[model samples]
Target: MPSVHIRYDNLKPAVKQVLFGRLRLESTRWASFKSWYQFSAFYCAPGEAGAHEKGGVEHEGGRFRRKHLVPPPQVDSLAELNERLAAIDVAEDARHIHGRPTSIGFDFEAERDRLRPLPDDDYDCGIDLTPTVARNSRITVRQGYYSVPAKFIGQKVRVKLRANELWVFDGRQVVARHPRLTRRYTYHDFLDHYLEILLVKPGAFAGASALAQARAEGGFTKVHEAFWAAAKQKAGDREGTRMLIEVLLLHRQLPAEALVKAMETCLRIGSVSTDLVAIEARKAMEGTDDDDAELLTGDGPADDAGGESAGQEAAGARVISLHARRLPPDPRTTLPDMSKYDRLLNLGTARETSQNQKGQGA
Candidate 1:
């Protein structure tokens, strides 16, 4: 998600005009393509050079690509490509190669001028970006499901879908694209997408519509259902479906092991409350701090900045200690007593009456 913060007082007029009064830039000079461009249109005198007029984009792009892209060994995987690109960016930004006299790093540190920042709102360029997958596989977007070809079930098919239109791609090859539906409930009807989701959580998705159809036509539902049933039994939770859904949601941001632990905790408790699962996942993530049990239990002191209590093993660890002090005597002891107090005071007379009766009997 891209977020933008706009402040007119810090923005240059040209950039502001481009943003159309919708956003603000954070700084007067900002880094683009590894070079700095000064936003001069806002504060410059008439007939002075502006951002585009100074050939800023052209100059910056050339230096950035040359410095970052052409490193010695070529990268192969997309993951490696992105990693290498980041490394190059860090290195170039740290040095002072661009005849700007000061290191780009130092200049950034020293400068405090403001322009509009990047907008936090999702930008819609109107280009279709559907990631394609095989007919058997499933892909997710915004917590919803979509389908692709079955042959590509295990393989990755890129969805080129944007916020509006959905597209799928098998590498550079475009397979299928469609306009995304406005609602989420309809997404599950996409057979291939449901099949893919079933692969991850067969128990919860066993009776799902797509799987039901596949079972009727292909006779595979029994096998899948058995697997899901076994998984549910192992988890020992009646709310397997809810737990599975929660696990899927968490898988987006957490590691597989952490999510698995979270699911286990949810199943054990027979509840899929997001709050409880999050607590367990954090505990699993931090790996059971022996000195910070309270942290894991979510009962650490409000001011426990030192994660010291985070792993405390004791159930009732004392975070704060109170000192012993003398207190004043009760004022009621010095005051005259009420009639109720007289009854207790007359207990001796009642006992003597009982004794006199016993002596007369004797």
Candidate 2:
């Protein structure tokens, strides 16, 4: 018998009793992958090592790459490279292979209805790990530290590490989510995650990495800093920071824009009271649509509908207007006379109605 060759050099250990491919031995991991997709594996005949390469199967990929990707593309990120590759693939679908009457796309379109439907449930193509939270309320994932809620400190959390995001779960409940760090040993933090700990150790709030990250990320606005400065000045650092943390905790229940607006409201009156901020936060939220919150976000006036600046109109969404395809004025039908209503309302005749309608023949 010839030795088995696998694409993966690091195949995980398989089921002890289960075996396949004429004593080639399948790993459990490989078996599970195949079973999930309902895929069947066929290998070379016994004592025929070169049999699998009979169709030039392995060389097709190399040939395709050389043909399509001969000149390496310059891209800023993997996302950009993938986008470029997708465009290239779409372009190649129109290409006519040698001896084929129809283009690749035409053949594919003809057979598309015959292809098997994809699995209903999506496969999670992400790495999973369980990491214990450190004293700093952080977990090390692929040499990158990510902050979790302080309540989970010293406890193990399950993490799903995806291509661009990391999701931290305490049991089935998601506790934290952060963008995956591109650099090794780098860390990402959220200010809300550290609020509970900061409340107890008020002195730490000023120098906390989470606080710095929040400020840089626009989550901590100038309004928050202004409120904090006022609170500290009025009540001193220890007491003031504790109060700020209390207000920060409200973020779990309230929207960020509400908190920002509430902070601004309180700061206007020189108050650092957490109770007042809560009152204002609720007031800011009363009768408010979720989308309206974007306008009030404290960083600045954000772009509104049609990319217009927020300051264009405070009550813009309420302004109603009607528009439609312009039907040319029928020379036979006279325009409605609004002069009577306009005169009664004392707004003056609304642009003199067409006196020349009859003269402009139908």
Candidate 3:
């Protein structure tokens, strides 16, 4: 946590500005570098420096590569590779150094006690960029397209690109987030983002990238396909697709696994109605039985004739009809008469006429 010595080559703009004490370095303009300035002091080695200038660091790099990465371990993911490297580091910590009396682990423990504690706040290492959402509700970052909410189409948004994920912000509020895609020209889409638009154009939902990704990820289960086919058979293609869209929209309110399970149960029963699907999906989400749910939803069938009459007699409930109430007349208040106002108007006219006649006689 003391001062760090780094090579001058490939220096960040903030570090360069702080070291050189100038707004422009060589021909590059300095950008906001508040993050680098807040932490430990930085010392840059001379340009084109020899290995002897940073001998310890250079030697350590070679030792690490030879000791741990020589064979180049094969791993499925970056997480797995990091796990292997961490294990290697822990194992190496027990080995004694060339001149040291104790192991590297002991030395590190002794030095760590004397070193300064880390700062309270972790540094923000993400790169921030502003990208406008395309009309198709996607934003391109580093040649990889990511979907935002369709409502944000044609609007500029802030993107924070981290090592493993990307956070999207519309102003201060985060609107969308996705795992970072390393492949160029690849897209990460969420089916929920396209649901609103797909409802209006059901045909486009079949060929949508979001749906395709969902299928690839197994999020679109076999039950969904079965239900869609059944719906299409019952209704036409467009109406069936719309029905499917309604089912998909349930994902907004229900857990995905629950919705899929409900769809599976519906498929087993050969029920393809959207209403049935919604009822079953809600039951699944609430972890309730079908009969109980039917009763609660008021969709359960009535009992047999004798059972119904018996139940009605046992309940003894009466239905009351509601009628509009009429207001009573008030005897204390009466309408104003117009005759007094008319006499006042005639008196004013007679005064005006007498004044005009007297002026003519004079």
TM-score head-to-head 2 vs 3, winner: 3
Model 2 residue 302 distance off true place after TM-score fit, in angstroms: 32
For residue 295, give model 1's deviation from the true position in Å.
26
Candidate 2: misplaced stretches above 4 Å? 1-27, 41-108, 288-362
Worst 10-residue lDDT window, candidate 3: 318-327
Tell me the TM-score of model 2.
0.59
Error of 2 at 113 (Å): 1.6
lDDT of 1 by residue, 1-362 (tens): 11222122223422433433334343322423112222322332213334444345457777777766556446433356667777877776678755678887777656534333535553443343344343545666655566665566667655654645667777777655554655564453344445335556556564577655545555333323443344456565445544444444554477756655655655544454556667777777987532244433445445434466434525555343211212355667476758787887699789999999999999
Candidate 3 C-alpha RMSD relative to the actual structure: 15.1
State the displacement of the C-alpha of residue 169, model 3, in Å, after optimal TM-score superposition.
1.9
Angstrom error of the Cα, residue 311, model 2: value is 31
Q: Which has the higher lDDT value, candidate number 1 or candidate number 2?
A: 2
The CA lDDT of each predicted structure is 0.51, 0.72, 0.74
Ranking by TM-score: 3, 2, 1
Better of 1 and 3 by lDDT: 3
Per residue, candidate 2 scores C-alpha lDDT tens digits across 16-114 of 332454345776556776565665554444335544534554476687789877887766445666788899889989989778999989998887876
Query: Between the candidate structures 1 and 2, which one is better when assessed by TM-score?
Result: 2
Collision pairs in model 2? 14-28
